[model samples]
Target: MSDASINASTVTTQTRVNEASFGDYFSLLKPRVMSLVVFTALVGLLAAPVPVHPFVGFCAILFIAIGGGASGALNMWWDADIDKVMKRTKGRPIPSGKVEAGEAMALGLALSGLSVIMLGLATNWFAGAFLGFTIFFYVVVYTMWLKRSTPQNIVIGGAAGAFPPVIGWVAATGSMTLEPWLMFALTFMWTPPHFWALALFMRSDYDDAGVPMLTVTHGRRATRWHILVYTALLALLAVGTAFSGIGGPIYLTVAVVMNALFLRGAWQIARRTEDDSEADNYKVERSFFKLSLLYLFLHFGAILAEALLKPYGLGGWS
Candidate 1:
Protein backbone atom coordinates (compact mmCIF):
# COMPACT_ATOMS: atom_id res chain seq x y z
CA MET A 1 0.00 0.00 0.00
CA SER A 2 1.01 3.60 -0.53
CA ASP A 3 1.78 5.84 2.44
CA ALA A 4 -1.65 7.46 2.23
CA SER A 5 -3.36 4.12 2.17
CA ILE A 6 -1.32 2.92 5.10
CA ASN A 7 -2.26 5.98 7.11
CA ALA A 8 -5.92 5.46 6.32
CA SER A 9 -5.64 1.84 7.36
CA THR A 10 -4.04 2.89 10.62
CA VAL A 11 -6.89 5.29 11.38
CA THR A 12 -9.44 2.62 10.60
CA THR A 13 -7.77 0.11 12.85
CA GLN A 14 -7.54 2.58 15.70
CA THR A 15 -11.21 3.53 15.40
CA ARG A 16 -12.21 -0.12 15.60
CA VAL A 17 -9.94 -0.58 18.56
CA ASN A 18 -11.00 2.54 20.50
CA GLU A 19 -14.71 2.85 19.57
CA ALA A 20 -14.34 6.60 19.19
CA SER A 21 -17.48 8.76 19.01
CA PHE A 22 -18.82 11.74 17.03
CA GLY A 23 -17.76 14.16 19.77
CA ASP A 24 -14.24 13.11 18.94
CA TYR A 25 -14.55 14.60 15.49
CA PHE A 26 -16.12 17.80 16.84
CA SER A 27 -13.29 18.11 19.31
CA LEU A 28 -10.97 18.74 16.38
CA LEU A 29 -12.33 22.30 16.25
CA LYS A 30 -11.32 23.05 19.82
CA PRO A 31 -14.76 24.31 20.75
CA ARG A 32 -13.77 25.69 24.14
CA VAL A 33 -11.14 27.94 22.64
CA MET A 34 -13.47 28.84 19.80
CA SER A 35 -16.14 29.96 22.28
CA LEU A 36 -13.73 32.43 23.85
CA VAL A 37 -12.76 33.60 20.35
CA VAL A 38 -16.41 34.12 19.51
CA PHE A 39 -17.19 35.94 22.76
CA THR A 40 -14.22 38.32 22.54
CA ALA A 41 -14.88 38.96 18.87
CA LEU A 42 -18.51 39.71 19.68
CA VAL A 43 -17.51 42.14 22.39
CA GLY A 44 -15.23 43.89 19.94
CA LEU A 45 -18.01 44.11 17.39
CA LEU A 46 -20.56 45.41 19.85
CA ALA A 47 -18.34 47.81 21.75
CA ALA A 48 -16.78 49.46 18.70
CA PRO A 49 -18.43 52.85 19.45
CA VAL A 50 -19.76 52.59 15.88
CA PRO A 51 -23.03 50.80 15.42
CA VAL A 52 -23.43 47.78 13.15
CA HIS A 53 -26.71 46.23 12.12
CA PRO A 54 -27.61 43.41 14.49
CA PHE A 55 -27.84 40.76 11.79
CA VAL A 56 -24.58 41.86 10.26
CA GLY A 57 -22.95 41.77 13.66
CA PHE A 58 -24.18 38.23 14.21
CA CYS A 59 -22.88 37.12 10.86
CA ALA A 60 -19.53 38.78 11.40
CA ILE A 61 -19.02 37.04 14.73
CA LEU A 62 -20.24 33.75 13.29
CA PHE A 63 -17.79 33.83 10.43
CA ILE A 64 -14.99 34.81 12.79
CA ALA A 65 -15.82 31.82 15.01
CA ILE A 66 -15.93 29.57 11.97
CA GLY A 67 -12.55 30.86 10.90
CA GLY A 68 -11.17 30.15 14.36
CA GLY A 69 -12.58 26.64 14.27
CA ALA A 70 -11.11 26.06 10.85
CA SER A 71 -7.72 27.00 12.22
CA GLY A 72 -8.13 24.52 15.06
CA ALA A 73 -9.13 21.71 12.70
CA LEU A 74 -6.21 22.39 10.40
CA ASN A 75 -3.86 22.53 13.39
CA MET A 76 -5.00 19.09 14.52
CA TRP A 77 -4.57 17.69 11.03
CA TRP A 78 -1.05 18.99 10.63
CA ASP A 79 0.06 18.21 14.16
CA ALA A 80 -1.36 14.71 14.29
CA ASP A 81 2.02 13.11 14.85
CA ILE A 82 2.84 15.34 17.78
CA ASP A 83 -0.70 15.15 19.10
CA LYS A 84 -0.41 11.39 19.33
CA VAL A 85 2.70 11.69 21.47
CA MET A 86 1.52 14.48 23.79
CA LYS A 87 -0.44 13.30 26.78
CA ARG A 88 -2.52 16.47 26.78
CA THR A 89 -3.44 15.98 23.10
CA LYS A 90 -3.32 12.23 22.54
CA GLY A 91 -7.10 11.99 22.52
CA ARG A 92 -7.62 14.60 19.80
CA PRO A 93 -9.64 13.53 16.77
CA ILE A 94 -6.79 13.01 14.30
CA PRO A 95 -4.54 11.41 16.86
CA SER A 96 -7.29 9.26 18.30
CA GLY A 97 -8.16 8.14 14.75
CA LYS A 98 -11.72 9.47 14.97
CA VAL A 99 -11.06 11.87 12.10
CA GLU A 100 -8.73 11.29 9.22
CA ALA A 101 -6.12 13.98 8.62
CA GLY A 102 -7.37 14.39 5.07
CA GLU A 103 -10.92 14.78 6.32
CA ALA A 104 -9.81 17.44 8.78
CA MET A 105 -7.82 19.29 6.12
CA ALA A 106 -10.80 19.30 3.79
CA LEU A 107 -13.18 20.52 6.49
CA GLY A 108 -10.76 23.20 7.54
CA LEU A 109 -10.16 24.44 4.01
CA ALA A 110 -13.86 24.42 3.16
CA LEU A 111 -14.67 26.34 6.29
CA SER A 112 -11.85 28.75 5.59
CA GLY A 113 -13.19 29.63 2.12
CA LEU A 114 -16.82 29.70 3.23
CA SER A 115 -16.26 31.86 6.31
CA VAL A 116 -14.14 34.43 4.48
CA ILE A 117 -16.48 34.72 1.50
CA MET A 118 -19.61 34.86 3.61
CA LEU A 119 -18.08 37.38 6.01
CA GLY A 120 -17.16 39.63 3.09
CA LEU A 121 -20.63 39.40 1.62
CA ALA A 122 -22.34 39.84 4.96
CA THR A 123 -20.11 42.54 6.39
CA ASN A 124 -17.19 43.89 4.31
CA TRP A 125 -14.08 42.87 2.44
CA PHE A 126 -11.81 44.09 5.19
CA ALA A 127 -13.24 41.67 7.75
CA GLY A 128 -13.15 38.80 5.27
CA ALA A 129 -9.54 39.46 4.37
CA PHE A 130 -8.61 39.65 8.03
CA LEU A 131 -10.37 36.38 8.72
CA GLY A 132 -8.58 34.77 5.79
CA PHE A 133 -5.21 35.94 7.09
CA THR A 134 -5.96 34.73 10.63
CA ILE A 135 -6.82 31.26 9.35
CA PHE A 136 -3.74 31.08 7.16
CA PHE A 137 -1.45 32.31 9.92
CA TYR A 138 -2.80 29.86 12.47
CA VAL A 139 -2.76 26.84 10.19
CA VAL A 140 0.21 27.43 7.92
CA VAL A 141 2.47 29.80 9.79
CA TYR A 142 1.85 28.74 13.38
CA THR A 143 0.95 25.06 13.17
CA MET A 144 2.96 23.93 10.17
CA TRP A 145 6.03 26.12 10.54
CA LEU A 146 6.71 27.89 13.84
CA LYS A 147 5.30 25.18 16.08
CA ARG A 148 8.03 22.65 15.40
CA SER A 149 10.81 25.00 14.41
CA THR A 150 11.22 27.57 17.16
CA PRO A 151 10.63 28.31 20.84
CA GLN A 152 9.18 31.70 19.86
CA ASN A 153 6.23 29.96 18.19
CA ILE A 154 3.58 31.27 20.57
CA VAL A 155 5.12 34.73 20.68
CA ILE A 156 4.71 35.29 16.94
CA GLY A 157 1.80 32.98 16.20
CA GLY A 158 -0.25 34.58 18.96
CA ALA A 159 -1.14 37.14 16.30
CA ALA A 160 -3.62 34.67 14.84
CA GLY A 161 -5.62 34.67 18.05
CA ALA A 162 -5.10 38.39 18.50
CA PHE A 163 -6.68 39.33 15.15
CA PRO A 164 -10.30 38.61 16.00
CA PRO A 165 -10.94 41.86 17.87
CA VAL A 166 -9.32 43.89 15.09
CA ILE A 167 -11.33 41.97 12.51
CA GLY A 168 -14.50 42.63 14.46
CA TRP A 169 -13.66 46.30 14.61
CA VAL A 170 -12.95 46.39 10.90
CA ALA A 171 -16.19 44.62 10.18
CA ALA A 172 -17.98 47.51 11.84
CA THR A 173 -15.81 50.48 10.74
CA GLY A 174 -14.15 49.20 7.53
CA SER A 175 -10.80 50.18 9.04
CA MET A 176 -8.37 49.58 11.89
CA THR A 177 -8.19 51.56 15.10
CA LEU A 178 -5.95 51.91 18.12
CA GLU A 179 -8.62 50.44 20.38
CA PRO A 180 -8.58 47.09 18.61
CA TRP A 181 -4.78 47.02 18.59
CA LEU A 182 -4.89 47.43 22.33
CA MET A 183 -7.07 44.37 22.54
CA PHE A 184 -4.68 42.54 20.24
CA ALA A 185 -1.74 43.48 22.41
CA LEU A 186 -3.54 42.24 25.49
CA THR A 187 -3.91 38.78 23.98
CA PHE A 188 -0.45 38.77 22.46
CA MET A 189 1.20 39.57 25.75
CA TRP A 190 -1.00 37.09 27.61
CA THR A 191 -0.25 34.15 25.30
CA PRO A 192 3.26 33.31 26.47
CA PRO A 193 2.45 33.25 30.18
CA HIS A 194 -0.78 31.37 29.66
CA PHE A 195 0.79 28.73 27.45
CA TRP A 196 4.10 28.50 29.31
CA ALA A 197 2.27 27.59 32.48
CA LEU A 198 0.85 24.57 30.71
CA ALA A 199 4.22 23.85 29.19
CA LEU A 200 5.83 23.88 32.60
CA PHE A 201 3.78 20.91 33.59
CA MET A 202 3.60 19.28 30.18
CA ARG A 203 7.26 19.66 29.23
CA SER A 204 7.81 15.94 28.88
CA ASP A 205 5.07 15.66 26.27
CA TYR A 206 6.77 18.24 24.04
CA ASP A 207 10.08 16.55 24.62
CA ASP A 208 8.64 13.23 23.51
CA ALA A 209 7.04 14.80 20.45
CA GLY A 210 10.22 16.71 19.60
CA VAL A 211 8.26 19.98 19.60
CA PRO A 212 10.43 22.97 20.47
CA MET A 213 8.28 24.51 23.18
CA LEU A 214 10.29 26.85 25.42
CA THR A 215 10.23 24.42 28.32
CA VAL A 216 11.45 21.63 26.06
CA THR A 217 14.33 23.51 24.45
CA HIS A 218 15.35 25.90 27.23
CA GLY A 219 15.48 24.78 30.83
CA ARG A 220 12.41 25.07 33.06
CA ARG A 221 14.00 27.95 34.92
CA ALA A 222 14.10 30.00 31.74
CA THR A 223 10.52 29.08 30.91
CA ARG A 224 9.40 30.19 34.38
CA TRP A 225 11.26 33.47 34.08
CA HIS A 226 9.76 34.05 30.65
CA ILE A 227 6.31 33.44 32.08
CA LEU A 228 6.94 35.96 34.87
CA VAL A 229 8.19 38.58 32.44
CA TYR A 230 5.30 38.08 30.01
CA THR A 231 2.75 38.15 32.82
CA ALA A 232 4.12 41.47 34.02
CA LEU A 233 3.99 42.86 30.51
CA LEU A 234 0.51 41.53 30.02
CA ALA A 235 -0.57 43.25 33.21
CA LEU A 236 0.89 46.53 32.04
CA LEU A 237 -0.88 46.28 28.71
CA ALA A 238 -4.18 45.34 30.33
CA VAL A 239 -4.11 48.35 32.64
CA GLY A 240 -2.89 50.57 29.82
CA THR A 241 -5.97 49.63 27.79
CA ALA A 242 -8.09 51.15 30.52
CA PHE A 243 -6.51 54.56 29.98
CA SER A 244 -7.06 54.29 26.21
CA GLY A 245 -10.85 54.88 26.35
CA ILE A 246 -11.75 51.29 25.52
CA GLY A 247 -11.91 50.65 29.25
CA GLY A 248 -13.31 52.54 32.24
CA PRO A 249 -12.99 52.74 36.02
CA ILE A 250 -14.49 49.27 36.49
CA TYR A 251 -12.05 47.76 34.07
CA LEU A 252 -9.16 49.64 35.56
CA THR A 253 -9.96 48.41 39.04
CA VAL A 254 -10.35 44.83 37.87
CA ALA A 255 -7.20 45.06 35.79
CA VAL A 256 -5.13 46.34 38.69
CA VAL A 257 -6.30 43.82 41.29
CA MET A 258 -6.37 40.86 38.92
CA ASN A 259 -2.92 41.72 37.59
CA ALA A 260 -1.56 42.06 41.08
CA LEU A 261 -2.69 38.52 41.85
CA PHE A 262 -1.39 37.33 38.50
CA LEU A 263 1.97 38.95 39.18
CA ARG A 264 2.29 37.29 42.54
CA GLY A 265 1.48 33.93 41.01
CA ALA A 266 4.06 34.44 38.29
CA TRP A 267 6.63 35.43 40.90
CA GLN A 268 5.90 32.26 42.82
CA ILE A 269 6.30 30.21 39.67
CA ALA A 270 9.58 31.90 38.84
CA ARG A 271 10.95 31.36 42.29
CA ARG A 272 10.23 27.66 42.10
CA THR A 273 13.09 25.27 41.37
CA GLU A 274 13.51 22.23 39.14
CA ASP A 275 14.40 20.12 42.15
CA ASP A 276 10.81 20.50 43.30
CA SER A 277 8.58 17.54 42.58
CA GLU A 278 5.92 17.82 39.90
CA ALA A 279 3.07 17.46 42.39
CA ASP A 280 4.37 20.28 44.54
CA ASN A 281 5.41 22.70 41.80
CA TYR A 282 2.48 22.04 39.49
CA LYS A 283 0.03 23.62 41.94
CA VAL A 284 1.28 27.15 41.33
CA GLU A 285 1.61 26.59 37.57
CA ARG A 286 -1.85 25.10 37.22
CA SER A 287 -3.43 27.81 39.37
CA PHE A 288 -1.83 30.45 37.22
CA PHE A 289 -2.99 28.63 34.10
CA LYS A 290 -6.61 28.61 35.22
CA LEU A 291 -6.41 32.21 36.39
CA SER A 292 -4.95 33.21 33.05
CA LEU A 293 -8.08 32.02 31.27
CA LEU A 294 -10.28 34.00 33.62
CA TYR A 295 -8.05 37.04 33.33
CA LEU A 296 -8.71 37.72 29.64
CA PHE A 297 -12.37 36.84 29.72
CA LEU A 298 -13.14 39.07 32.69
CA HIS A 299 -11.17 41.98 31.27
CA PHE A 300 -13.14 41.84 28.04
CA GLY A 301 -16.34 41.29 29.90
CA ALA A 302 -15.65 44.47 31.88
CA ILE A 303 -15.16 46.28 28.58
CA LEU A 304 -18.53 45.03 27.43
CA ALA A 305 -20.13 46.22 30.63
CA GLU A 306 -18.53 49.62 30.23
CA ALA A 307 -19.81 49.80 26.70
CA LEU A 308 -23.33 49.00 27.84
CA LEU A 309 -23.21 51.58 30.57
CA LYS A 310 -23.10 54.40 28.07
CA PRO A 311 -25.23 56.58 30.37
CA TYR A 312 -22.16 57.66 32.30
CA GLY A 313 -20.27 58.02 29.01
CA LEU A 314 -17.49 56.14 30.78
CA GLY A 315 -15.84 54.56 27.72
CA GLY A 316 -14.88 57.84 26.07
CA TRP A 317 -17.56 58.55 23.45
CA SER A 318 -19.58 61.22 25.23
Candidate 2:
Protein backbone atom coordinates (compact mmCIF):
# COMPACT_ATOMS: atom_id res chain seq x y z
CA MET A 1 0.00 0.00 0.00
CA SER A 2 1.18 3.52 0.81
CA ASP A 3 4.25 4.49 2.80
CA ALA A 4 2.12 6.09 5.47
CA SER A 5 0.01 2.94 5.84
CA ILE A 6 3.15 0.80 6.02
CA ASN A 7 4.56 3.03 8.74
CA ALA A 8 1.32 2.83 10.70
CA SER A 9 1.26 -0.97 10.43
CA THR A 10 4.86 -1.04 11.66
CA VAL A 11 3.93 1.05 14.67
CA THR A 12 1.05 -1.30 15.43
CA THR A 13 3.38 -4.29 15.49
CA GLN A 14 5.81 -2.80 18.02
CA THR A 15 6.83 -5.43 20.60
CA ARG A 16 5.70 -5.76 24.22
CA VAL A 17 7.58 -8.90 25.28
CA ASN A 18 10.96 -10.44 24.62
CA GLU A 19 9.49 -13.87 25.31
CA ALA A 20 5.88 -15.00 25.00
CA SER A 21 4.32 -16.52 28.10
CA PHE A 22 2.24 -19.70 28.21
CA GLY A 23 -0.78 -17.51 28.75
CA ASP A 24 0.17 -15.43 25.73
CA TYR A 25 0.14 -18.56 23.62
CA PHE A 26 -3.20 -19.55 25.12
CA SER A 27 -4.53 -16.10 24.43
CA LEU A 28 -3.92 -16.75 20.73
CA LEU A 29 -6.71 -19.30 20.95
CA LYS A 30 -9.35 -16.70 21.67
CA PRO A 31 -10.62 -18.82 24.57
CA ARG A 32 -13.67 -16.70 25.32
CA VAL A 33 -14.94 -17.00 21.78
CA MET A 34 -13.87 -20.63 21.70
CA SER A 35 -15.95 -21.30 24.82
CA LEU A 36 -19.11 -20.26 23.00
CA VAL A 37 -18.15 -22.49 20.10
CA VAL A 38 -17.54 -25.41 22.41
CA PHE A 39 -20.73 -24.85 24.37
CA THR A 40 -22.92 -24.64 21.30
CA ALA A 41 -21.15 -27.57 19.70
CA LEU A 42 -21.64 -29.61 22.88
CA VAL A 43 -25.29 -28.72 23.00
CA GLY A 44 -25.58 -29.79 19.38
CA LEU A 45 -23.86 -33.09 20.09
CA LEU A 46 -26.00 -33.83 23.10
CA ALA A 47 -29.20 -32.62 21.53
CA ALA A 48 -28.88 -34.94 18.57
CA PRO A 49 -31.49 -37.73 18.49
CA VAL A 50 -28.72 -40.30 18.38
CA PRO A 51 -26.39 -41.08 21.26
CA VAL A 52 -22.64 -40.59 21.58
CA HIS A 53 -20.56 -42.37 24.17
CA PRO A 54 -19.52 -39.96 26.88
CA PHE A 55 -15.85 -40.36 26.05
CA VAL A 56 -16.48 -40.05 22.32
CA GLY A 57 -18.61 -36.99 22.95
CA PHE A 58 -15.87 -35.49 25.06
CA CYS A 59 -13.26 -36.11 22.40
CA ALA A 60 -15.47 -34.66 19.71
CA ILE A 61 -15.99 -31.44 21.64
CA LEU A 62 -12.32 -31.19 22.53
CA PHE A 63 -11.31 -31.48 18.91
CA ILE A 64 -13.97 -29.07 17.73
CA ALA A 65 -12.79 -26.63 20.37
CA ILE A 66 -9.25 -26.97 19.10
CA GLY A 67 -10.43 -26.36 15.57
CA GLY A 68 -12.22 -23.28 16.83
CA GLY A 69 -9.07 -22.05 18.53
CA ALA A 70 -7.06 -22.67 15.40
CA SER A 71 -9.41 -20.45 13.50
CA GLY A 72 -8.98 -17.85 16.24
CA ALA A 73 -5.20 -17.86 16.00
CA LEU A 74 -5.25 -17.54 12.25
CA ASN A 75 -7.74 -14.72 12.54
CA MET A 76 -5.54 -12.93 15.03
CA TRP A 77 -2.54 -13.41 12.82
CA TRP A 78 -4.27 -11.88 9.84
CA ASP A 79 -5.97 -9.12 11.76
CA ALA A 80 -3.01 -8.08 13.86
CA ASP A 81 -2.74 -4.77 12.08
CA ILE A 82 -6.36 -3.86 12.55
CA ASP A 83 -6.33 -5.36 16.03
CA LYS A 84 -3.73 -2.81 17.11
CA VAL A 85 -5.93 -0.01 15.85
CA MET A 86 -9.11 -1.31 17.47
CA LYS A 87 -9.35 -0.74 21.21
CA ARG A 88 -11.42 -3.87 21.70
CA THR A 89 -8.68 -6.06 20.23
CA LYS A 90 -5.45 -4.17 20.86
CA GLY A 91 -4.51 -6.37 23.81
CA ARG A 92 -4.66 -9.63 21.84
CA PRO A 93 -1.54 -11.78 21.55
CA ILE A 94 -0.38 -10.60 18.17
CA PRO A 95 -1.41 -6.96 18.39
CA SER A 96 0.18 -6.41 21.75
CA GLY A 97 3.25 -8.29 20.48
CA LYS A 98 3.02 -11.04 23.09
CA VAL A 99 3.47 -13.55 20.26
CA GLU A 100 4.76 -13.26 16.73
CA ALA A 101 2.30 -13.51 13.86
CA GLY A 102 4.35 -16.33 12.37
CA GLU A 103 4.11 -18.20 15.65
CA ALA A 104 0.35 -17.78 15.70
CA MET A 105 0.10 -18.91 12.10
CA ALA A 106 2.23 -21.99 12.75
CA LEU A 107 0.20 -22.91 15.81
CA GLY A 108 -3.04 -22.40 13.94
CA LEU A 109 -1.99 -24.58 11.03
CA ALA A 110 -0.69 -27.36 13.25
CA LEU A 111 -3.85 -27.42 15.35
CA SER A 112 -6.11 -27.27 12.32
CA GLY A 113 -4.78 -30.52 10.92
CA LEU A 114 -4.52 -32.18 14.30
CA SER A 115 -8.03 -31.25 15.39
CA VAL A 116 -9.66 -32.26 12.10
CA ILE A 117 -7.90 -35.62 11.91
CA MET A 118 -8.54 -36.44 15.56
CA LEU A 119 -12.17 -35.42 15.32
CA GLY A 120 -12.63 -37.61 12.27
CA LEU A 121 -11.09 -40.61 14.01
CA ALA A 122 -13.13 -40.05 17.15
CA THR A 123 -16.43 -39.34 15.47
CA ASN A 124 -16.82 -39.53 11.69
CA TRP A 125 -15.33 -38.11 8.52
CA PHE A 126 -18.32 -35.85 8.14
CA ALA A 127 -17.62 -34.05 11.40
CA GLY A 128 -13.92 -33.84 10.62
CA ALA A 129 -14.58 -32.46 7.16
CA PHE A 130 -17.00 -29.96 8.62
CA LEU A 131 -14.42 -28.67 11.08
CA GLY A 132 -11.82 -28.22 8.35
CA PHE A 133 -14.25 -26.29 6.20
CA THR A 134 -15.18 -24.07 9.15
CA ILE A 135 -11.55 -23.10 9.72
CA PHE A 136 -11.11 -22.35 6.03
CA PHE A 137 -14.29 -20.30 5.90
CA TYR A 138 -13.38 -18.22 8.94
CA VAL A 139 -9.72 -17.63 8.13
CA VAL A 140 -9.76 -17.57 4.34
CA VAL A 141 -13.19 -16.28 3.48
CA TYR A 142 -14.18 -14.07 6.38
CA THR A 143 -10.88 -12.86 7.76
CA MET A 144 -8.96 -12.43 4.53
CA TRP A 145 -11.74 -11.43 2.19
CA LEU A 146 -15.16 -10.38 3.42
CA LYS A 147 -14.21 -8.71 6.70
CA ARG A 148 -12.35 -5.80 5.18
CA SER A 149 -14.37 -5.54 1.99
CA THR A 150 -18.04 -5.54 2.85
CA PRO A 151 -20.71 -4.72 5.38
CA GLN A 152 -22.37 -8.09 4.73
CA ASN A 153 -19.24 -9.82 6.06
CA ILE A 154 -20.93 -11.01 9.22
CA VAL A 155 -24.17 -11.92 7.45
CA ILE A 156 -22.50 -14.57 5.35
CA GLY A 157 -19.48 -15.42 7.50
CA GLY A 158 -21.80 -16.25 10.36
CA ALA A 159 -22.35 -19.62 8.72
CA ALA A 160 -18.90 -20.60 9.92
CA GLY A 161 -19.97 -20.12 13.54
CA ALA A 162 -23.34 -21.68 12.88
CA PHE A 163 -21.68 -24.89 11.68
CA PRO A 164 -20.56 -26.09 15.11
CA PRO A 165 -23.92 -27.36 16.26
CA VAL A 166 -24.39 -29.05 12.92
CA ILE A 167 -20.98 -30.65 13.31
CA GLY A 168 -21.93 -31.74 16.81
CA TRP A 169 -25.07 -33.34 15.44
CA VAL A 170 -23.13 -34.99 12.64
CA ALA A 171 -20.62 -36.33 15.14
CA ALA A 172 -23.45 -38.20 16.80
CA THR A 173 -25.55 -39.23 13.79
CA GLY A 174 -22.71 -39.53 11.24
CA SER A 175 -24.96 -37.71 8.77
CA MET A 176 -27.09 -34.65 8.20
CA THR A 177 -30.71 -34.02 9.03
CA LEU A 178 -33.27 -31.24 9.37
CA GLU A 179 -33.01 -30.95 13.15
CA PRO A 180 -29.38 -29.80 13.26
CA TRP A 181 -30.05 -27.25 10.53
CA LEU A 182 -32.67 -25.68 12.76
CA MET A 183 -29.97 -25.20 15.36
CA PHE A 184 -27.75 -23.75 12.67
CA ALA A 185 -30.45 -21.30 11.72
CA LEU A 186 -30.86 -20.19 15.30
CA THR A 187 -27.25 -19.06 15.58
CA PHE A 188 -27.11 -17.76 12.01
CA MET A 189 -30.03 -15.43 12.52
CA TRP A 190 -28.98 -14.34 15.99
CA THR A 191 -25.53 -13.20 14.83
CA PRO A 192 -26.55 -9.96 13.19
CA PRO A 193 -28.46 -8.20 15.92
CA HIS A 194 -26.04 -9.60 18.45
CA PHE A 195 -23.03 -8.11 16.66
CA TRP A 196 -24.82 -5.00 15.51
CA ALA A 197 -25.56 -4.11 19.10
CA LEU A 198 -21.87 -4.32 19.81
CA ALA A 199 -21.24 -2.24 16.71
CA LEU A 200 -23.73 0.29 18.02
CA PHE A 201 -21.63 0.91 21.09
CA MET A 202 -18.26 0.14 19.55
CA ARG A 203 -18.71 2.04 16.33
CA SER A 204 -15.44 3.82 16.91
CA ASP A 205 -13.60 0.53 17.03
CA TYR A 206 -14.67 -0.44 13.53
CA ASP A 207 -14.23 3.10 12.39
CA ASP A 208 -10.72 3.27 13.74
CA ALA A 209 -9.86 -0.15 12.37
CA GLY A 210 -11.59 0.55 9.05
CA VAL A 211 -13.49 -2.73 9.24
CA PRO A 212 -16.61 -1.64 7.29
CA MET A 213 -19.12 -2.73 9.91
CA LEU A 214 -22.80 -2.04 9.25
CA THR A 215 -22.59 1.02 11.46
CA VAL A 216 -19.72 2.40 9.39
CA THR A 217 -21.11 1.71 5.91
CA HIS A 218 -24.81 2.28 6.52
CA GLY A 219 -24.78 4.79 9.41
CA ARG A 220 -26.02 4.25 12.96
CA ARG A 221 -29.71 4.84 12.19
CA ALA A 222 -29.61 2.27 9.44
CA THR A 223 -27.66 -0.09 11.65
CA ARG A 224 -30.31 0.36 14.33
CA TRP A 225 -33.05 -0.46 11.84
CA HIS A 226 -31.05 -3.40 10.63
CA ILE A 227 -30.82 -4.69 14.16
CA LEU A 228 -34.58 -4.41 14.56
CA VAL A 229 -35.26 -6.23 11.31
CA TYR A 230 -32.80 -9.01 12.04
CA THR A 231 -34.01 -9.36 15.61
CA ALA A 232 -37.58 -9.64 14.34
CA LEU A 233 -36.53 -12.31 11.87
CA LEU A 234 -34.51 -14.10 14.54
CA ALA A 235 -37.50 -14.06 16.88
CA LEU A 236 -39.73 -15.61 14.23
CA LEU A 237 -37.26 -18.37 13.45
CA ALA A 238 -36.55 -18.95 17.14
CA VAL A 239 -40.18 -19.17 18.10
CA GLY A 240 -40.97 -21.25 15.02
CA THR A 241 -38.27 -23.78 15.97
CA ALA A 242 -40.27 -24.40 19.12
CA PHE A 243 -42.86 -26.20 16.98
CA SER A 244 -40.34 -28.28 15.07
CA GLY A 245 -39.16 -31.77 15.97
CA ILE A 246 -36.51 -30.38 18.34
CA GLY A 247 -39.02 -28.08 19.94
CA GLY A 248 -41.07 -28.98 22.97
CA PRO A 249 -42.77 -27.23 25.87
CA ILE A 250 -39.54 -26.31 27.56
CA TYR A 251 -37.80 -24.97 24.45
CA LEU A 252 -40.96 -23.24 23.34
CA THR A 253 -41.41 -21.56 26.72
CA VAL A 254 -37.80 -20.40 26.74
CA ALA A 255 -38.04 -19.25 23.13
CA VAL A 256 -41.16 -17.18 23.72
CA VAL A 257 -39.81 -15.49 26.82
CA MET A 258 -36.30 -14.73 25.52
CA ASN A 259 -37.49 -13.66 22.11
CA ALA A 260 -40.02 -11.29 23.57
CA LEU A 261 -37.31 -9.62 25.59
CA PHE A 262 -34.95 -9.64 22.61
CA LEU A 263 -37.50 -7.99 20.35
CA ARG A 264 -38.22 -5.36 22.97
CA GLY A 265 -34.54 -4.57 23.23
CA ALA A 266 -34.25 -4.27 19.48
CA TRP A 267 -37.25 -1.99 19.41
CA GLN A 268 -35.76 0.27 22.02
CA ILE A 269 -32.55 0.43 20.04
CA ALA A 270 -34.34 1.22 16.81
CA ARG A 271 -36.34 4.09 18.27
CA ARG A 272 -33.25 6.10 18.97
CA THR A 273 -30.95 8.64 17.33
CA GLU A 274 -27.20 9.10 17.68
CA ASP A 275 -27.95 11.77 20.22
CA ASP A 276 -30.15 9.42 22.18
CA SER A 277 -27.43 6.78 22.17
CA GLU A 278 -24.70 9.23 23.18
CA ALA A 279 -26.85 10.76 25.89
CA ASP A 280 -27.38 7.44 27.62
CA ASN A 281 -23.90 6.13 26.78
CA TYR A 282 -25.56 3.51 24.58
CA LYS A 283 -26.94 1.84 27.70
CA VAL A 284 -29.67 0.06 25.74
CA GLU A 285 -27.17 -1.06 23.14
CA ARG A 286 -24.80 -2.34 25.81
CA SER A 287 -27.66 -4.14 27.54
CA PHE A 288 -28.68 -5.70 24.27
CA PHE A 289 -25.08 -6.81 23.68
CA LYS A 290 -24.99 -8.41 27.14
CA LEU A 291 -28.36 -10.06 26.56
CA SER A 292 -27.23 -11.36 23.19
CA LEU A 293 -24.50 -13.37 24.91
CA LEU A 294 -27.03 -15.18 27.11
CA TYR A 295 -29.61 -15.51 24.35
CA LEU A 296 -27.78 -18.22 22.42
CA PHE A 297 -26.54 -20.00 25.53
CA LEU A 298 -29.99 -20.30 27.07
CA HIS A 299 -31.51 -21.45 23.78
CA PHE A 300 -28.85 -24.11 23.42
CA GLY A 301 -29.20 -24.98 27.10
CA ALA A 302 -32.92 -25.44 26.57
CA ILE A 303 -32.18 -27.69 23.63
CA LEU A 304 -29.72 -29.64 25.73
CA ALA A 305 -32.34 -30.00 28.46
CA GLU A 306 -34.87 -31.16 25.91
CA ALA A 307 -32.47 -33.74 24.59
CA LEU A 308 -31.56 -34.93 28.07
CA LEU A 309 -35.21 -35.24 29.00
CA LYS A 310 -36.14 -37.19 25.87
CA PRO A 311 -35.51 -40.57 27.51
CA TYR A 312 -38.37 -39.93 29.90
CA GLY A 313 -40.83 -38.93 27.16
CA LEU A 314 -40.58 -35.35 28.37
CA GLY A 315 -38.67 -33.73 25.46
CA GLY A 316 -40.00 -32.66 22.07
CA TRP A 317 -43.58 -33.18 20.95
CA SER A 318 -44.29 -36.82 21.48
* Candidate 1 stretches greater than 4 Å from native: 1-22, 277-281, 311-318
Every candidate's CA RMSD: 4.4, 6.1
- Candidate 2 regions exceeding 4 Å error are 1-17
Candidate 2 — worst ten consecutive residues by lDDT sum?
10-19
Kindly list the per-residue Cα lDDT of model 2 for residues 184-297, writing each as its tens digit: 999999998988899889869999899999999999999999999999999999999998878899999999999999999999999998899899899999999999998999
How would you encode candidate 1's per-residue C-alpha lDDT over 223-283 as one tens digit per residue? Answer: 9999999988888889888888688888898899899999999999999886663758688
Q: Give the TM-score of candidate 1.
A: 0.92
TM-score of each: 0.92, 0.94
Candidate 2, residue 88: lDDT: 92
lDDT of each: 0.87, 0.92
